[model samples]
Target chain A: MTHPPLRSEAAELHLSHQPAPEDLERPGRRQLSPADAALMEQKVRKVEVAISLVLRVGVLVSVLVIAVGLGLMFAHHRAYLPLQGDFSYRQLTSGTTPFPHSMASLARALARGDGRGVVVLGVLVLILTPVLRVAVGVVSFLYEHDLPMALVTLYVLAVLVGSFLLAGV
Target chain B: MTPIDFVVSLALVSVAAGVLGSLVGLGGGVVIVPVLTLLYHVDIRLAIGASIVSVIATSSGAAAAYVRERMTNLRAGMFLEVATTTGAVSGAYLTTVLPTQALFVLFGVVLAYSSFATFRRRHTDQPLTVSNDRIANYFDLHGSYYDPAEKREISYKVVGTRPGLALMYVAGLVSALLGIGSGALKVPAMDSAMHLPMKVSSATSNFMIGVTAAASAGVYFIRGQIDPIIAAPVAAGVLLGATFGARILGRVASTTVRLVFVVVLVVISLEMLQKGIFP
Candidate 1:
């Protein structure tokens, strides 16, 4: 894709006379080589890709875990099967529905090979996905040498973790 | 109902909720809560718990592609998370200690207002050329995204930073207290207050809602509100539906999307007001 030399040269002359307004509007506007622009775009794109991958993987894993748990539950609990009118299902979702809520109880349920415990673990994974995204943002910002943003992201992470800890207790 | 019948029916309904929620950045709680409580006859607390977990699934699942395509202004989302996460944590705590009937009425009124505001400005696709907001500038909240529907790159500057952040705090609080993504509030804040393009606003809101929901998800879990039996199917269905919806977002017209969002807001507000007044 070669532009005619004379046309390109004339275009350059026109650009020299009237620079692109978008260039002037950019913060810290200055001359930047095409290579530099590409490099910066590449860097920004890398960060986007990384964040995207984290989210995709998190979702994939959580959904799979949940599906597996559902499978296990149906396999083990024949009484709660959909064949007949089962009060067990109703009781499990009712006002006094008894299930593990705390970590210690959850761990005990899991040790007993309870599928509900595995499903809860999957839910925990879903809840933490966005927290992990914040952690990634911290690293991405630090990599770009953006101290302010890194600190902002770190603060968000701290608040999320703190809320979890404070709530768990 | 049998266990299989229960799970399958709930999952099917949740898939519809997820599609709508993912498209509007609303996290489908608007649909999940009502369907589970009103239609399924589940307890309200259990319904809310399932809805909150579904919100996390919807946001993260939809946000994956939005981030990849640069529709999400990650910087803007992160910056606002500072305010939203704080608000959410407090809101989670307050849910146990405070009475919320009045708050529900107030939130409904606010949503009605936001719906009107969003409708009034539905046609402004052009981004602000100049923003004097020092905070937005300092944080580089400005960004550009490629719009496949328009087939062009759109660059935009952010304005009204202070007001946007304030609205987001309220959004977070509402979400935590009500088990919603609160995108009904967030899209308006970004569209009218911050003057971002509609698609960017929607995507960024979607990106932000997950963190906001995650902030309070642990609290709900500890309170025994998050029943794994109810939540597991909802989460899986929402994620699947959200993945499909995310593919359609970039191809849809922004104004059409905004209109759909405004409709959701109006309906939800009316429902909220009805519950507050009657209950």
Candidate 2:
């Protein structure tokens, strides 16, 4: 029923992947089902390409935002330290933490065009690149009809979101 | 040093680290932490947070090209994520309870072992001589990619699926515990245990690290370790270098890559081992 997963399909699919379903469906289409699977495979390939683009764009966007922030920081203070070092970890036992109270506060600061906020937003985009990739992966697997893989990727995504939300609590 | 001067210097250093790390299939975070904490006198935990973000950046930048070339084993990567994600969550907690120095030494030993595993150089064109692997068969884990340099398609069959998955769990735990070791372990596991081709292993490793690092980066952010000024330029530099590295991965010889990996692994392992022993 599964058609042996591409070993057999490779010969036919690789030969002609351009023909649409309508072109191949002209009555008595012997290879219609395999063609459909091949089409599905091609669609899955698009998802991979999309994932690649998302990662590339996300990183560049983050870099741009961070660069702008650095510029602003230097414009404000061209001295010993352009920005505050409050986020730096002192030690485990020091207990005097300077981390922002929540993600919302960080976002608010970013909206206010604070230099540090812009910088953090860049890092935020960097972190989200992987999360976005995993999200696309779920769609990729489902398109391939590979339910198990979809479930696995979905679970990984869940772990990421859950850990972020529950880390402080 | 002025803060602007410090960030500039750190970003410059990170660019080279990113290039070398990405070229050898180890993301830049491995070296970033050492440079920050030891050379610049940054807090170890703060260096860790910055490096984690850099790992995601490097992985993301490299994965774009690697995955597009069809070298990454998507299904295999997904299957292993189940193990990695679970291991990562547990390892995050382990950080609070365990003696981290001893764990670092242990992971350093593992790195040494991995270096030895990949020390040999083999021709990349040689076909994977595997057969009758039941799990890989059902999952269709085998893949093929066109080698522009070799002027042919390189087909390979993935064996040791279960071992690969189990090793990923260890890699994830070690990564969470150590902050950059996970990405380095992936290629070795794929190359030795799974008998995957070197190029495929590295590319898949690139594809997988972002997800693994993301699992922990979140915790680092919430804990107040990810400093924007520190993390930003470092991430940008690493991402830039990794993007360049990914484009050339298809052209570079596997033998050369393996030899370079062995050298980097030995140096990093010795450094980590030394730190653990002295600290």
**Local distance difference test scores for all models:** 0.82, 0.74
Error of 1 at B242 (Å): 0.5
In the range B1-279, model 2's lDDT, one tens digit per residue, is 557667778889878877776777777887888888878777777888888877777788888778888878877887778788787888898888877788778777777767875774354335454434456655567778876567677887666666667778878887888776576778877777667778788778877777888888878887778876678678878888887887777887778777877888898889879879997
Collision count for each candidate, in order: 0, 1
Q: Show the lowest summed lDDT stretch of 10 residues, model 1 chain B.
A: B123-132
Expressed as tens digits, the lDDT of each residue in A63-108 for candidate 1 is: 8888888888888888677556745467778979888899998899
lDDT tens digits, residues A22-64, model 2?
3322234244388886886687688788888888788789889
lDDT of 1 at B86: 91
Please tell me which predicted candidate would have the highest DockQ against the true structure.
Answer: 1
Give per-model TM-scores.
Answer: 0.91, 0.85
Off by over 4 Å in 1: A1-35, A83-88, B96-98
